[model samples]
Target chain A: MSDVFGVGVIGAGPVTQAIHLPTLARMPDRFRVTAIMDVDEPVAESVAGRVGARHSTSADDLIGDPGVDVVAVCSPHRFHAEQVEAACYAGKAAVLCEKPLALTVADAERVAQVSRETGVPVIVGAMHTFDPGWLGAKANWGDLQETVRVVNSSIVLPWNARYEDWATQILRRPPPGEPVADDALSRSVAVRDAVLGLAVHNLPHVRHFLPDVESVDWAESVDPYGYLVTIRGGGIIARLLGNMHGYWKPSWTLDAWAADQSLHVEFPPSYVQAGSSVATLTSDTQTRRFGGVEANGYEAEWLRVWELAAGIVPQGEDLQATVDDLIYAVRIADAAADLVRGEHARDRVR
Target chain B: MTEFADRPHLVTLPSGPAHRDIAAALASLPRSFRPGAGEDAIVYVTGDDDWPASVEHALSVARRAIVVIQPGYAQPSTVLRLAERAATDSVPVMIDYAFASNPAVVLAAAAWSAAVEPTGILDVTSRHAGDGTGPMAVLLDQLAALHSLVGPVRTIRQLHIDGDAHSAVVAIPVGGGVITATLLGARTELGSRGSRVRWLGPTEALELEVPHAGTAGPGYSRHVTTEGEQLAPTIYENAHRATLARLSRHLEAGAGRCDDLTTLAGHLELVPREHPSRSASQRTSDQRAN
Candidate 1:
């Protein structure tokens, strides 16, 4: 029961080198980065060297390191399930995993199963859902679930250089592979992964307002880099879309409408410490706006994860709920990719 | 095609007081303020006892566009046929939906295509705080705006409300997505009288809120986000002023009808052949017209 706990982070890439380490530095008194690991030994050693933590080329070695009290899975999306399962089985104080929460529904469920059996608190980094401003808005909205009419979300984002360059530069990252030759199945899967990557960030937030996603109406890829999806259920419909393009700045909004009341949540872009997301509610009698909670979700997320790891908070969220949220995101992605492929096939015939 | 020889005069048959408000609003304008026609821009017909007959005569004699202030379109077919005639005669027609003409509605419509393009799933909720709009007219006016956005709707499927005053969830097919409108007539405590239209796609999203007619303070057109915080002052004109201004633009642009019959046909799917049909504002127009 040491006051300062040890944190072992797997994947010493930008997220670790840039996001978590900086966030951990801000909360130095409560937690420490003990062991860092990545597939690339140089990246592991370089990032570890700066943070004063040991480096490992093997993820298991880092997870099992004696000084490590908490395990953070920040590796590629596909590795989330196994690494999270490994960390949970290792009985780390807690496990913090970045999202998609492991690509497929089955993988997500398996990871959930492991977390449950191990009784280790696991948190998915759907950061905006953790913001104080969003929590404030959620607290204020009442009876909207039953009365919501339409849910519309729009995100127009620019290049990542705005925040990416703010931290330590990783100049020697591996280049991305060429696009996989598109067969019907691979094209559909690619569309699913691509859509999920951008849109899932908000699915967790949208579910907070309307949870019943009975069926997907139509999901289409708008241009080269984004998707437009409409999901219906819970006596309401939700329209969700996000794109990465030439925005003057980041414009991301989750808007929910009801007969008398509406909720709007605006999220701050990633990798910065600007301010918390802003949420405003408008109703018949009055309109209320909330903001100035200067801590961003990225920072807030680390603090919360540290609190749970330190047994300071009641382990934040349940695995089942996280699984359902992750599954909903997957459902949206699959539905959208299926639709785009369907239209493509139909177009070929015509 | 060559342009009309002279500037078009605005012809508004004396329909009601609301009708007069519009005609007066137009007549008050000098020819220079309006396009084409000079100070002699407006002709307000006073001699006719038969309302429909006067419009027929006015349509023939008027040099340019015709204005129907709240044409109850009691027989939707009759007014639509007149619009068709106006189109054939190369005359533009403006059917003014005054409540919808507020600066907010105009500005939001102006912002739609550029800010957030719709990818099929276009949803609109038309609810009156205290049943702000009459039975079928509420659906029609809202549908008219929707037609402009989603192209022609192909079908409309209506769902029921439980023990509610008058609530129906109507889904209409347009393009790749569907336009769903939930019209609640008898719920004031739950919400105020206003219409919110939202367009959502993968790349962009937008929501526009239009308050019920005559609800706002004068000279107030401001842009606000979905959360109801004012964004900026909008370029707004009164719906009455906007309808006329739009007509002038149509005339200048050689405009005939705004939404064609095919578009109306798409809208007709939402209106049952025998829904309690009446022009909600025709009474106000009649009071003013006489």
Candidate 2:
């Protein structure tokens, strides 16, 4: 392995162009972009030109390149699992698959199996998991994981374009689609996508305290784009609320409470290169805060990939945890979708 | 405005959850109002005790007005009866909700209602210590706050309630649409204990935070629209003092209808105490079965 790991990114959309490229540009000593791939040749060439890396329209070409030691699967949701498997099978040292690793359980299992079989480390890009503040709270919160009784996750944000335009110049943008149909099936699908697309960013943290989901007590789809879901598990009740609209200021917060202790994390909105989240842990007598650091979760994740590729950390346990996180997120999404569908069916019966 | 021969005397009963705080607020009343005994005295009572009897006694004796502090769980019939008696006697009544009566809440109500779109959800969270009033009281306090900010609650459904936490879904009727409010209450001994109401609309967002009623700390409200962000002016007065000031104003005016009891009756109807005698899991299962 070279002193600086070579990164091959599979998608050059807004996330790749706005988040990853700018993040990698910050850690020049630890990582270098070796190749960029996108379905659009112009987008691939235009984005790759900025970093002086090779551009291609094929995932195979990038994954097979000898210079690409680590692969970042930033393609659309459906392509994540297959590309991750290919990257691991091609003997890459490590792979960073942008969130959801896979949409379905079977695909996620396949990615896990491939990584296990190839002995290649895979890190799903649920950046909050790698956030310095979240990590700090985990280290300092004593017995909170067991004692936590209520967990709440809330996210309210403006459209991604609002922040993406501020993050970097874009080469290609996906065109707007038709509005979602106002029907049971369409609403259920919308909610499922919401859970997997937006809430998946923090379900891993919610599942950390509420490890087992016993039931989804209630689920409702808000108008515009939002969902309210409540699930009970492991003697803890967790409520997840998300809404995306044209609001000016974005708020993303996670709060948990035990009898005498509490944890609160306020994360910066996505697509903006803001620093790490600010986390506060409060006990009966004292309060401690972590994170005023310059490094955001995107940088922290890449550093983790560099560590895994350089053999600075073991892959066995971390790989299983990644798979477990994926399973947790899938369980939540499936349950919420089913509940929403059931409610809609009942409404129609009435 | 009617001119009284002398200032109205303030009388505070020593009962209920916030008796000590109410007493302190009465002691700090402005010179226009005095604390003593008189026929036209303003009666203050919190609802945790035998409030019906206390309010009845106040109605019989006081000629000026009545102020109820943090009415806990009251039967709709009982509250309506009290409202009728207050009406017949022509004694104005005011309910002092810890968070709702904050000066900041009063200032932000107009902006909040004007800018908030009904399409999205309104999130309300209240954190309290378990050693304080129980979860029911805390929930009622939140409902009162909501009533003040968004008007009457049209419907409410209890999602879950255990030893330390309570969750409910409520719908408030806005101009032409109904906005859903998700209310969550948790009992914790840590953190800055308070109640927070937040709403994010398409082009505007409003968040209001009110500290515990015991302190005179200023409640904070922030409003953000496309144009820019604005914060409501801070006021260092707790709910008790503010409620007293409101009652003083009502007395000085002498002829306004008091709807506190009516609103409380409406809020109580939305959260009836006689929930189904089944576990939350069983209730959820039954809902799914239906």
Q: Which model scores highest in lDDT?
A: 2
User: Per-residue lDDT of A1-350 in model 2, one digit per residue for the tens?
Assistant: 67699999999988998899999999899899999999999989999999999999999999999999999999998899999999999999899999978888888888888898999999988899999999999999989999998899998887787788777764254533444576888888888888888888889899889998998887777667778888887778888999887658888999998888999999999888899999999997888999858899999999999889999988867767877888898888888889889887875775
- Deviation from native of the Cα of residue B140 in model 2, angstroms: 1.9
lDDT of 2 at B71: 63
Q: Model 1 - which docking category?
A: incorrect
Residue-level lDDT of model 2, residues B1-290, one tens digit each, is 53442644656454555778877887787454666667867777766535666788888998778887666665567689999999888998888876777777887787777766677788999887644346666777778788778877887744576777878888788879778898888887764788899886766778899887778899889887877788888788898888877776676677656888888888767764455312332354355559
Point out where model 2 deviates above 4 Å.
A171-179, A345-350, B1-5, B36-42, B53-65, B130-132, B272-290
RMSD per prediction, one decimal? Answer: 8.5, 4.5
User: lDDT of model 2 at residue A22?
Assistant: 93
